[model samples]
Target chain A: MLTDSERERYSRQILLFGEEGQERLKSSKVFIAGAGGLGCPAAAYLAAAGVGHLVIADCDSVDRTNLNRQILHYESDIGRPKVVSAREKLLSMNPDIRVEPLAVIISDNNASTLVSGCDLVVDALDTFTDRYALNRAAIRNRIPYIHGAVSGFDGHMATIIPGETACLECMVPEAPPRSVFPVVGTTPGLIGVLQAHEAIKQITGQGEPLTNQLVLWDGKASQFTMIRVERDPDCPACGGDSRASGRRREI
Target chain B: MRVQVKAFAGFREILGPDIALELPEGSTLTGLLEGLGRRSPGIQKALFDDQGTPLKSVIIMVNKKRQTRAEFVSRELHDGDEVAIYPPVAGG
Candidate 1:
């Protein structure tokens, strides 16, 4: 049900991708697991692209430090919960899309339920524990997950299509230790844009997604490299008698 | 063989962005970290744990392929494999 203004507003993108792509975007449900640096731009682009529904999950309040790269928030939003602010910004961008703001930290306990209903999960979260939890949920639910990470000038992105490609656990067995790390807001912005690009590709079946490959970007060198990832047969989540195979392996 | 090492986050501030290292033909990831510690004492605190072990969160990737702490010592390196060392940073 595109109104005259709605159709006209999206006319250029529609002309390039056609009504079918637009419809696919309109029907897809995407879950963004964080509302910070990467999540803001990624979710914003998806909403603007007409994604039918977006569930933004986060428990943190906005801080002044987030202003540099978190394009969805304003100075007035500093003390507001990121999910609340993100949803408002997204809905303001495109009211046609449904926005769900879950102001809770995504953890092992709630990841399955949170991820169960979405067509795809976007790993915009920063912590390794949450990323691994999302990886497990994606594998258990048999859904595709787009992974992104950034530290300072470097960032990386990958797409994991469970049972079809390698999961994040197979690529890195352990999470990096949590510490205060440096980041330029633009790093997440760069990676988030790529994540959104891959999500769209997954939705419309347009281009080749980075399944079983890690795309690394070194902003210092201005270099982009793709590392081929092989599934570890021993991966606990996607390997052996995991649900992906419909059996249980002794842990 | 000499390889170029790039450290990110805290490592960048401690080790000064990049360094060149000369190692034996079969240096492990542990060996490289030890070498780095010797060359730059500032990196020791950021790269090692209380028990003098490499921090688990310090990601060691050779040419973009991730290597576990155990594999760090056993994984062979070619002439131009760029080893990237990263500290954890959260992204929203």
Candidate 2:
């Protein structure tokens, strides 16, 4: 049941999703990987929206260079761990919610444990080396994964539900080329919000998820295009016999 | 045959939103990409490496339908087919 304060605090969104939907938000827990550009906005929105629990994991400390995009970290946070800075800000944003910030890198061995009881996972990490680990963990746990990435003025996002749609590997079969990539803050800002929007829609049952449609945002052309995607039966990750446990079934 | 090529991400900066390419009826998707390279050196450099091998990260689709990586070299284009190329962004 919503306390009087929750009812008051969420009044605006409640007008949108009603009290029952707000309860869903209050009960759901989300695992957000990374505390960088994408993760910053994603966490902020989800936190403000009253996602009951958020487990944010990142190993790096804040750098002077991160201020251009990482909104959660301030100048004083330069030497602080990303998860620590993010957690402090997020808790202040809404003390009603719980934030569990893990100060560690997410890799192959620990991905499953990190995501362990969470309702969903947010892929806001920059590197595929870590993204793939989270991907398999989401699959193994039978939870939905919101995938987003950005570079310069370009960004893309998709919702991955194991067994029901194409996994990350099926879409980005190989890791993309690496470089000292350039980005304006707005790229991750937009993509991260879209990811949070997808998450809210998923948890509240208010709308359809992205499913097989990949949203490619071209900030240069100011174009948002939805291209169809599908699973590869031979995809090494979520393919054939190698697939992790399927979706959380209805039964 | 004229095919509408839609480019996204880095490719969009080079090829704009859409470019109409005239290809021989039996041209494979690879051939069309090579044709695009011939049309613009920017695309040539972005789509290929120093040795001219196509970058595996470039995703190709037909009429908005994603084609498997192997189909990139083998799939043939038809008149009026919408071919989209997306070089996905890797950074956050």
Q: Per-prediction DockQ scores?
A: 0.43, 0.79
TM-score of chain A taken by itself, candidate 1: 0.95
Tens-place lDDT per residue, model 2, B1-92, is 99999888778878888888888879998898788888777889877877887876788889888888588788988999999889888887
What is the CAPRI rating of model 1's predicted complex?
acceptable
Alpha-carbon DockQ of candidate 1: 0.43
Off by over 4 Å in 1: A1-6, A240-251, B26-30, B45-56, B68-70
Worst 10 residues of 2 chain B by lDDT: B48-57
Looking at model 1 chain A, report the run of 10 residues with the lowest lDDT sum. Answer: A242-251
Clashing pairs in 1: A38-B92, A39-B92, A126-B91, A176-B57, A177-B57, B28-B73, B29-B72, B29-B73
Local distance difference test values of all predictions, in order: 0.81, 0.88
